[model samples]
Target: MAKQRIGIYPGTFDPITNGHLDIIKRGLRLVDKLVIGVATNPSKDPMFSLSERVAVVERETHDMAKVAGVEIDVMPFDELLMKFAERVGADIIIRGLRAVADFEYEFQMTGMNYQINPNIETVFLMADPRYQTIASRLVKEVARYDGNIEAFVPSMVASEVVKRVNESKV
Candidate 1:
C-alpha cells in the first residue's frame, strides 16, 4: 500500500512553542507530508492576529531541514475540525497530549473527527516532560507579569510577545 500523502496538525498556536515544534518534527517522520494548521478562533480574543501568528510560525520553522519537506499552512475556520482536515487533503490528524486533561479533550475530539470522516485518523503524540506544563495561556500570563518567556516560545515569538505587551501598556 502507498503511504499516506498528507497529515494535518492543527492548533491555535497563539505563540508557537518548542513543544509544538517537537510534535511537528516527530509527526513529519510518520507521514509523507505534514501541514501545520494555524486555526483561527474568533469567539475568544487572541493576542496576535492569524496573519501574525502565521508569520511567526513560518519564521521559526524556516531553517528546519528535518521537516523541510513538510509544508505549513494557516487556516481560519469556525467549523468542525474534521472538515478542516478533509479540506486540507489530510488522511491523518496530529495531536499532542500534555496530560490527562489534554487526553480527555483530545479523546472527545478524536471520536468526533472519526465520526465525521472515518478515513481520517487522529494520532496523539505525548509531549516531552519538559513541556508538559507549558501552554500559550501560561506563556502569556507570565509575560503579562513581565516574566521572561524566552524558554517557553521561539525567539522570534518571544520578541513578538515583548513587543505586543509593551504596546498594550501604552
Candidate 2:
C-alpha cells in the first residue's frame, strides 16, 4: 500500500484566525492527511493557554467534514520543529506566507527543519486576499484596544478573546 501524504500545519495559534483556517483548508486539497499542530512557545506570552487554544481549534474545525478529516493536536516544544513533525509522522510542513516578511522568516525555518530531516518539505501557501494582513498578533492587538476582531477570527475564538480580555482586567 502507498504511504499517506501527511502534512503538519504548526503554529502557536494563540488564537486560530480565519487566515490560519484559510491555509489549512487550502492545504488539505494537496495532502491526504492534515495535522494541525498547536505549538506552545515559551518565548512568547500567549493570550490563551495551550489547552485553551487546542480546544478552540477543535471547536472551530469539528463540524467541517473536510477539516474533520484533519487531525487536531497540541504540542509544547522548545527544540527544533522538525522533531515535532517527525513525532507526528508528517512528511510535509504547511506554512502560510502573507508577505515578503513572512517568507523570509519561514524560509530560514524551512532550511533549519530540512537540515534536521531531509525528507520533510515545507510548503508555503499564499494567504487569501481577504486575510492577507490578518495575523494572531494583530488580532490580539486589535482586541486589546477594544477594536472589533469579528472578521479576523472564527466566531468561537472571537468570543473567547472577549472573555479573556474581560477576565484579564479583573
Candidate 3:
C-alpha cells in the first residue's frame, strides 16, 4: 500500500484571506492530508487572537476539506516552522506565491529549511490572478477603515473582522 502523503501549510492566518484559501484548495490536491499550521507570529500584530484565527481557519476550511475528500487539521504553533512540520510528520511544505517580492523571502526560507531537513520538500503554488492581491494584512487595513473586505475574505471571516475592528475601537 502507498504511504499517505501529508503536507503542512504554515502561515500566520491572521484572518485567512481568499488568497490563502486558494493555496489550501490547490494544496489539498497534492496531498492526502493537510495540516494548516497557524503560526503564533507576534511580529504581525495580528488582528485576531491565536484561538480566533484558528477558529476562522477551521470554519472556512471545513467545507473545502469535505468536498475535496482530503483530511485537514488546523493547529497552532509557536516554534520554528520546520520543527512544527516535523512534529506533524509532514513530508511536504506547501506555500503560495503572489509575486516576485514574496519569492525572494520564500526562496531564502526554503533554502534555510532545506539545510535543516532536506527530507521534507517545499512546494510552491502560484496564487490565482483573482486573489493575487488579497493579503490578510491589506484586508485588515481595509476593515480597519470600514472599507469592504467581503471580496478578500470569506463571508463569515469578513463579519468577524468587522466585529473585531469595531470592538477594538471601543
All candidates: CA RMSD (Å): 1.8, 1.8, 0.7
lDDT tens digits by residue: candidate 3, 21-106? 99999999999999999999999998888999899899999999999999999999999999999998999999999999999999
Every model's TM-score: 0.92, 0.92, 0.98
Task: Give per-candidate clash totals.
Answer: 0, 0, 0
Question: What shift in Å separates residue 133 of candidate 2 from its native position after superposition?
Answer: 0.7
Residue 125 accuracy (lDDT) in model 1: 96
Which residue pairs clash within candidate 3?
A: none
**Highest TM-score model number:** 3
For 55-144, candidate 2 gives per-residue lDDT tens digits of 887776665535456544434544557887888788999999999999999888888887888999999999999999998989988988
Those runs of model 1 whose alpha carbons end farther than 4 Å from true positions after fitting are 1-4, 65-68, 74-78
Could you give candidate 1's per-residue lDDT for residues 137-166 as a string of tens digits? 889889989999999888878888988999
lDDT for model 3, on a 0 to 1 scale?
0.95
Q: What is the lDDT of residue 5 in candidate 1?
A: 74
Error of 3 at 28 (Å): 0.5
What TM-score would you give candidate 3 relative to the actual structure?
Answer: 0.98
